[model samples]
Target: MPFVEMSISLEGVSILLKIMVTGKVVAVGNFSRYIEDSRKEAIELISKLLGVTIEEAEEEVNITKGLTVRKAWLKTWWSPNWKSKPFTYPPVQCTERAFLLYLLSYTLFVDKSGSRVSIALLKLLENLDDVGNYAWGATALAYLYCQLGSATRVEVLQIVRYLTLFEGWVYEHFELRFATSNAKYMDQLQPRVSRWIQKHETVNVGDKLA
Candidate 1:
């Protein structure tokens, strides 16, 4: 049996590499329900990886949706590779899990800010590179900041600091795999600060420097 690490990119949004135990497949029935369960499991896995308490992980992932397994094939979101082969699993690989957390964090921060959720997100996708788990971490951090906005309440700051520290720790994996220039990525991500600043034109510098 070959223990293969396969790196797959999906629709330019995110990249996921799985270490598959080949010939070891888990057959699933009721795609929708299974898919939802898969997502929850993915979050739990990441939370475990990040060493977050169970309570904290639950607090972070508040809104979980239920899916119908019979109708799973109908929705591409449930399928990691919508255009490619169908996955027997809900496709909750490490990369996908990271991306989900990232988006959830972003939504929290952005909504916390004054910008309407729609407009804030409309800006996030611009120049967003959908590569590597680190990119997902960056995106998630951005979202957390958006959810936190300029006024970082004590509790929100704690979450932001915890996640940002985790981001620094996990970034090495992506650096080894992708080997893209850090300077370049930093440059790309800097634009997000401008967007944040725009929202807080009159705010103090200390408050907005996330």
Candidate 2:
């Protein structure tokens, strides 16, 4: 396995994040020679070999290295190519995950400035509902939230609570159902049955629900 070690610093605080690539390497022809190259070169080589954008290739490598059997299975299940020969995952799912990972990777490894972090967070909020629909989506969203600095995490949580009041909807997933619940005093969610209201209102409003 090959790995990349990266450091991100914000204010006076520093954090480290790792990108690991797992699996045996079966290099053919001249490709094997580049294995000993520097990390930057190695990343470029991997990008070219995989025929993916550099960011996409990097995300794929990290996901492949870190993904468990269950996650891989869910990704495969959500993929549009599930019925195709050789199997292919859904591009939309891939793109969404890649974007999330990119945001996380950039924030954790490249820049941790306030403006950059805010932009990334807004992007997450904007796509919050769509990302929640994917298998393991809520988990991914939570992971992204955890990556933020302490204060930012609290702010994001508050924003998520506000969004849940309007945009949240119930799903088959227990995590999501539990998240969007709104029973108030009964250990339910906030705003008192917001998910129920959102569902009914969505039905009544047709496509106007936002």
Candidate 3:
């Protein structure tokens, strides 16, 4: 679905907001409120749009709630003095696979767009799992590249290779130390990294063997 921008008056001032609407269902920026206010309407809308049963729509709504909670936990986790106050924000543990599926549904199916995952979600995932694990990083990268929509097939393959071999480890081990650190370096380096990966993959094995 396309993002629809609307202007509203608040206290005689104009504020512009972007919302995702599928059919008659509108998902405003405040997801929680939208869910609370239009729970039934949303479920009906989702079921009609996606051709899913109401039960499945309910499940998707629940998964979205989990995503919201996890996002909040991540903000606390990445905050200053997080270690000193480990209990400041308790973790909300759900099946990582479930979260991933919900993320795909929310971004692709519901939003119907390839916008980057919210920063809160990204930070949460980066810290939630072990780097050696492929699910979190791989899924995140795939979503990112999907949003970018400009990566070549070779570039995608290279990014997969790079993440599988190196990037995940760096994030898990070193990047979490500082709150305001270069946490988004990989995103910034995406273009250059894709180029490097493409070049590296194009080399002929026969030439090397010769």
Which structure among the candidates has the greatest TM-score?
Answer: 3
**Candidate 1 off by > 4 Å:** 1-40, 64-210
Q: What is the C-alpha RMSD of each candidate to the true structure, in Å?
A: 19.5, 17.4, 19.6
Residue 191, model 1: lDDT of: 24
Q: Residue-wise lDDT of candidate 2 within 1-210, one digit each (tens)?
A: 111222211210111111111222212133223233333343454344223457854564344342111223233334546445565444453445434433433322222331222112222323445433322222222343454434375445432211221232222122454344334423122212223333432211101111
For model 3, how does the per-residue alpha-carbon lDDT over 35-139 read when each residue is reduced to its tens digit?
Answer: 455556555544443334679557765765522322222233334353454343223332342244244334322232222222223222333343223232233
lDDT of each: 0.31, 0.30, 0.31
Candidate 2: residue pairs that collide: 79-90, 181-189, 182-193
Residue 50's C-alpha lDDT in candidate 3?
A: 33
Candidate 2: deviation at residue 168, Å?
3.1
- For candidate 1, what is the total of clashing residue pairs? 15
Could you estimate the TM-score for every candidate? 0.19, 0.20, 0.22
Residue pairs in clash, model 3: none
lDDT of 2 at 99: 43
User: Each candidate: how many clashes?
Assistant: 15, 3, 0
Cα lDDT over the full model 3 = 0.31
